[model samples]
Target: MQRKKPYLQPYWWRLLFRANGTAAWEAMGRGPLIPVPNAALTRAPLEVWADALLEEAPYELEDLHGDLLLECYAEPAVTDGTPPVYSRQVRLPGK
Candidate 1:
């Protein structure tokens, strides 16, 4: 008999970055020099979209390997009178 796969809900997207020089700028009060075009980053896979955000800096895919990191989740705005809640988790490539 085959085991059933668990149903995983697609939680809202977020970005995880290793705290470095360029990342520091985005973190500090430097303002967002590179504006995220839309909320697309959250929906796209990390490997596919992460590079675009790091375009101006020197970054390598391997650089992200085994590094302690910080993640930022762009919370969704609630239109109705409901409150907003954010989800977070430590995600590795190919869970």
Candidate 2:
């Protein structure tokens, strides 16, 4: 028996918005990545933080269409050194 690795590792969270919320004007947090062991814990704080930030602005909080999304994908560790699974290949000239 072996410890199996996760196929899709948890990545960044995408906070999407509509209406008056502009994605270009916003910036993601640059602080240390807090290891939240539970997904339930992550949602409340993220939503609260987003709401608090938006509250300071002129946008109507209720009117804003927003969702906190977890972005996950297969990490490099899962793909590295695996044969045809790799996409890029070094081709010899004229071959």
Best TM-score among the predictions, by candidate number: 1
Candidate 2 lDDT for residue 28: 29
Runs in model 2 deviating more than 4 A are: 14-24, 28-60, 63-95
Candidate 1 TM-score, C-alpha based: 0.23
Model 1 poorest 10 in a row by lDDT:
25-34
- Against the hidden reference, what TM-scores do the models get? 0.23, 0.22
Which one is best on lDDT?
1
lDDT of 1 by residue, 58-81 (tens): 243433432223233343332334
Compared with the true structure, model 2 gives a TM-score of 0.22
Question: Residue pairs in steric clash, candidate 1?
Answer: none
RMSD of 2: 16.6
